[model samples]
Target chain A: MNEGETRKPIIVLVRPQLGENIGKAARAMLNFGLTEMRLVEPRDGWPNPSAGPAASGADIVLNRAQVYASTADAVADCAHVYATTVRKRGVTKPVVTPAEASSEIAAAQGRSAILFGPERSGLETEDVALARAILTVPINPEFGSLNLAQAVILCAYECSKHEGLVQPTQEDLLPPAPQEELDGLIAHLESMLEPKGYFRPEARAEATRRTLRGVLTKPAWNHLEVRTLRGVLSSLQREPRL
Target chain B: MNEGETRKPIIVLVRPQLGENIGKAARAMLNFGLTEMRLVEPRDGWPNPSAGPAASGADIVLNRAQVYASTADAVADCAHVYATTVRKRGVTKPVVTPAEASSEIAAAQGRSAILFGPERSGLETEDVALARAILTVPINPEFGSLNLAQAVILCAYECSKHEGLVQPTQEDLLPPAPQEELDGLIAHLESMLEPKGYFRPEARAEATRRTLRGVLTKPAWNHLEVRTLRGVLSSLQREPRL
Candidate 1:
C-alpha cells in the first residue's frame, strides 16, 4: 500500500448490532475517503443482506471488510488504538476530540485504529482497556444522542482533512479596519459619550476611556463594519424627527 | 433572546422530502444544542407523520420547527445566509466548510442562517443567489453521498465546538522530561557513537553531532520514554551470550 493509504487509520466496529447500522457506518466511512473496516464478533454473523441496501452504494467497504474474533485481534497490528465513548469513563486514558485524534493519528509513526462500540450498549470495559486513549465527541450534554453511524462519520470526516482536502479560502473575508479608521470610530463614540456625561467622575475618566477602548478593539470590526457603526452613531446624534 | 441564543445560526431545510428525513434532521440539530429549525415548503407538507418516530426523541426541535412558504421568506430576518451544496456551482459566492461557517456565525453581529437543499435535488438557482456564501462539506471527491441528516449533523457538530463544551483535558499526558535528562540521553548515545567512530572525519564531527541532536530533540519524549531509551542503549552494550 502507498504511504498515504497506510497512514489512514482503520475503523474497527466492536460487537456492532443490526446489519442496517453496520451498512450506515460503511457509508459514512466511504463518504470521507476511509475504506478499511474491521468487524469484531457481529451479533448476526457476517454477510448480512440487510446491510447492502442501507450502505447506499458503499458496497466496496462492506465487501472487503475483515472480521475478527475479538477486539484485541482486530487491533493487533495497530500501534495506536483509540476507543470511542460518549460518557466519561473511570479509566485514566487521555480523552481527545475527533479532530484532535485525527491530528495525532496523522503524525503517528505506526498503524493507528479507532474502535467504536455497539449501538445499544457501548464498548465493554475490557474492550476499552486495550486502547491507549479515549476518543469522545463533545456534544450537547443535555441531548447527547449520537448514533453509531454519526460517530463514525464525524471521525472519518476529521481524518479526511489531513489527506489534503482543499481548505476553504479566506479571500472573501475583508481585513479588519485600518488603525486610522478604528481611531476615527472610537473618537466619534467618545465625543458623543462626553456630552452625555457617560464618562463622568473625573478621577476615573481615564480608566473608563481605556475600558471602552478595549471593548471596541476586541471586535476587530472590518472597514465596512466600522463605517456602519459610524453611521449608527451619527443617526443617534441626530434630533428625533417628530 | 440572550446573546448566546442569538448568535446560534438557524438551520433551514428548503423543499425537503420525506417526513422521516425531516425528523432525522431535527434529531441531528438538537444533538448539538441547536433548537431553532425552519422549513420551506416540505414535499409532504408540515407536521409529517413519519418525522416524529424517525427523530428518535428530538421532538422539541420538530415540535418547534417553523414552516415558511418560500426559502427567501425563511431567511429574511438573517443578515448572513449560506446555502449548502455538494458540488461546485456557477455562483460566485464564497465557499466555506462547516467549521469556517460556524466561526463566522459565532462572531456575526446579527442573525445567521444556513440553508440545506432538498434530498433528491439540492438548492435551486434562486436559493443560491440569495445566499451570501456557499457552505460545502469537503467530501471524498470520488464518492460524495451525504444524506440530509448526515449533513445537518456534521454542521451542528462543528458549531457545538464553539459553545463552551468541556474540552477533553490533557491531564493524563506526561510533560516532556527535563533538559538534564534529555542531555543525559544524548550524552550516552554520543559515548557509544564516539567509540565506534560513527562520527568520522574530524572536519564534519561537529555537524554530524548537531544533526543527531536535532532528530533526537524533535520528539520531546517524556521521562518514562527517556528511561526506556536508556535501557535499550544499555542492552546494546552487553556482551553476546554464547
Candidate 2:
C-alpha cells in the first residue's frame, strides 16, 4: 500500500449485529479510499452470505477484513483510537467531530483506528473507555437518526478530503467575455430600448442603466453565452417569421 | 419554518426508482436538519407504503415533500440549481464539491435546489442541463459505490455544518492533573520498579526513566486517573488476597 493508504484510519466495527450492515459499512469505507476493516466479535460472525449482496461489489474490503475477539485486541497496534457515538455519555474523554478526527488521523505518526458500535445498542461504556477520544457527528437536535453505514460514509468522506482526492474539474468552463463584447451587447440592448422610450425619464435613466448593468455584469457570461444573448435580442427585434 | 430552514436548499429526487431508497433519503435529509424534499416522477408513485417503515420516524420530511411532474417544474421557483453526479459529464457547468455547494447555498439569496437522480441510472443529460452547477463527491476512483441515501446524507451532513449544529459538549472532560500529582504517581511507580531491577544497567538508567516518564506524560491523565493508577500500583504491591 502507498503512504497515503497506510495513513488512512482502520474502521473497526465493535460487536456489529447484522451481516448486511457489515457489508454496507464496507461499501461506505471503500467509497472514500479506506480499505482496512477490523470486526470485534460481530454477532453473525465473519464470512456471512448476506454480506456479499449488500456490499454491492465492495468485496475487497470484506475479503481483507480481520475479525478480533475483543476491542482492545482489535486496536492493539493503533496509536490513536476514536470511538463513534451519537448520544452524550457520562464518560470523561475528549469529543471531536468527524472532520476534526479525520484531520488528526491524517497527521498522526502511527496508525489510527475509528471504532463504531453495533447497529442497535451502540458502544458499551467499557468499549468506549478503550478510546482516547470520542467522535461525534453533530446532527439535528430534534431528529438524530444516522444509520451505521451513513455514519461510516460521513467519516470516510471527511477523511478523503485530507487524502488529496481530485475534485471535479472545472476546465470545461470558459472564461467570461472580454470587456468590448460585453459593451457591445449592452449597446445593442440600449439601442432597442431607446426607440421604445425606455429612457424617457432622463432624471432616473442613469439609475436604471446602473441597475441593468449590475444585473448583466453579475453572471459574467462567457463569449458563447454573450453570443446567445445577442441572438436573442436580434430575434426580439425581428418581425415574426412565423 | 425559521429563516435558516427556509434558506436551506431543497433536495429534489428526479425519476427515483425504489420507494425504500426515497424514504431512506428523507431520513438522511432530516438527520442534518433538511426538511424540504421534492419528488419528480417516482417509479412507484407518491405515498408508497414501503416509505413509512424505511423512514424510521422521519415522516415530517416525507409528509411535507412536494411532488412534481418534471425536473424543470421541480426547480422552477429556485434561483440556483445544483445537480449531484458521480461521473464526469461533457456539460460545461461549474462543478463543485458538497462542501463548496453547501456554503454557496447557505449564503445565496432566493431559493436553491439540489437534484439527485434515480438509484440505478444517474441524472440524464437533459435533467442536468436544468442545473446551474454540478456537485460531485470526490471518492475512490477504483471503487465508487455510494448508494442513493449515502449520497444524500453526505450532502446533508456538509450542509448541517453551515447550519450551526451544536457540537458534542466536552464539559465532561476534566483538565490534566497538577504537576505534583503526576510526579507523585511517577515516583510511586519508580520506587516499585527500582526494587524489581526495571531500571537495570546504571549507565542507561536515566534514559529508561525518561522514556517511562514520557509514556506516562503523553496521556495527560486527569487527577482521578492519576489516583486510579496509584491505587493499582499499591494493590500490586500487596499480597494476593485469594
Candidate 3:
C-alpha cells in the first residue's frame, strides 16, 4: 500500500441502502484526504449511476472501492476496528470520540477500519459487536439525527487535522513592518491631523495620538502594505492629478 | 437576547446564490449547536422551496434565519466579525483557522459573527474589508474546492466543540459509585468466585485475586450499574436450567 492508503483509515459502509448516500459519504471522505472505501453489501450494488452525481468529482474513492458480503469480511484484514454508532450495545467495549479514534488510528500499526452503518437505521447490534471500540459524538438531545454525509464529515474532519494537509489558499503573509516604518506612518497621520484641528485642545493632543497609534497598530501591517498606506496618506495630503 | 441566542456566534451568508447551499449551511450550523443565521441579499430571494429538502430537517435554522441588505447590516451589532475567505486581497489582517476563530469567538465579549461569501466568487475585497480577522483552513493545494456547506461545517464543527450540547446517544454515565458501594461490589465478586476454586494454588491465588480486583474497578461504574452487575453474577452462580 502507498503512504496515502496506509495512513488513511478504511471507511467501511455496512449495508448502505442508497447510492446517493454512499456517494455523499465518499465526498465527505475525500474532503479530508481519506480515499479507500469498503462497501459491505451495498443495496444498490457497486457502479451505480446514482452515486456519481452525488459524489460530485470524488471519483478516486468510488473507483477504488472494494465490495464484501459481510461486515466481518470487510474488516477481516484490519487490526483495529471502530464501529461508528451512537447507542451503546449490551457488550462492553471502550468508547471514543472521532478525534480520539483518529489519533489512535494515526499511531496504530497495520490497517484500521471505521465502520459506518446503513443510512436510515444506523448499525445493528451485531455489527457493533465485532469492533474493538465504539466511536460516538455528543449531539443535540432534541434532534439527534445526523445524515450519513454529516457523520462521515465529522469523523473525516478529525482525521484530516492530524495529517499534514497543505492549506492552498493560505496567504504567505510578510512579517510585521519595522518599528521605524510604523513610527513614520503614525507621525505622518499625526501631521495631517494637526492642521485639520483634529487634535484640538492641547491638553487632549497626547491622549488623541495614543488612541490613533493603538488603532493603526491593531493589524500587524507588512512592510509593503505600510508603504502602500503611506502613499495613500501622502496622496491625500498633496494635490490630486487626473 | 436569550442565553442561547447571545452566546452563539451569528452565521452571515453574503450574497448566497442558491437556496440549497444556504439550507445546507444552516444544517451544518445547527449540527454544531449554532443557531441565528443571517443572510445578506440571498439570490433567488428567501423562502426558496429548493432549500427545505436539501436542509434534511434542520427547520429551526431555516425558520429563524435573518436577512440583511448588505454584509455591514448583517454584522452591525457584532463586536467580533470574522470573514471566511482564502484569497489575499492586498489587505493587512490577522488570519486564523476555524479552530482559532471559534476559540476567539467563544472568548469574545458582546455578539460575534462569521461571514461566508458567495458560491462562485467567494467574498469580495470590500466584503472582507469589514471583518476584524480572516478565517481560513488548510485545504488540498491541487484541488482547493470547498462547497458552501462543507465550508460551513468546518467552522461550525470547531465552534460546537465549546458548547455543551447534549449527546443523546451518550451513555447516561453516572458518577463512579460511592466508595462504600464499590467496596461491597469487590467483596461480593470475591465471595462468589471463592467457591468455584477459581483462585487455585495459595501462592498465585492472591496475585490472581488482585488482578481480578483491578479489572472490576477499572470502569467507573455507578451505584446502579454495580448492583446490576452483582445481580448478574449472583444469577450466573445459582442457575442451571431456564
Question: What is the C-alpha lDDT profile of model 3 across B109-183, one tens digit per residue?
Answer: 457788899999999866776666788776654445578888888788788776764323324434445434655
Candidate 1 residue-wise lDDT, B107-164, digit = tens: 8999999999999999999999999999999999988999999999999989988898
Ranking by DockQ: 2, 1, 3
Q: In angstroms, what RMSD does candidate 2 have relative to the true structure?
A: 28.1
Better of 1 and 3 by TM-score: 3
Candidates, DockQ: 0.14, 0.18, 0.06
lDDT of 2 by residue, B1-242 (tens): 67677669899999989899999999999999899999999999998888888999999989998999998788766766789999988766789999999887776655788999999999997677666678999999999888899999999988888886433334575445554566687788777666555666789777566555534443445566677566555654554342
TM-score each candidate.
0.71, 0.81, 0.77
Q: What TM value does the first chain of each candidate achieve? A: 0.68, 0.95, 0.89
lDDT of model number 2? 0.83
Candidate 2 lands at a TM-score of: 0.81
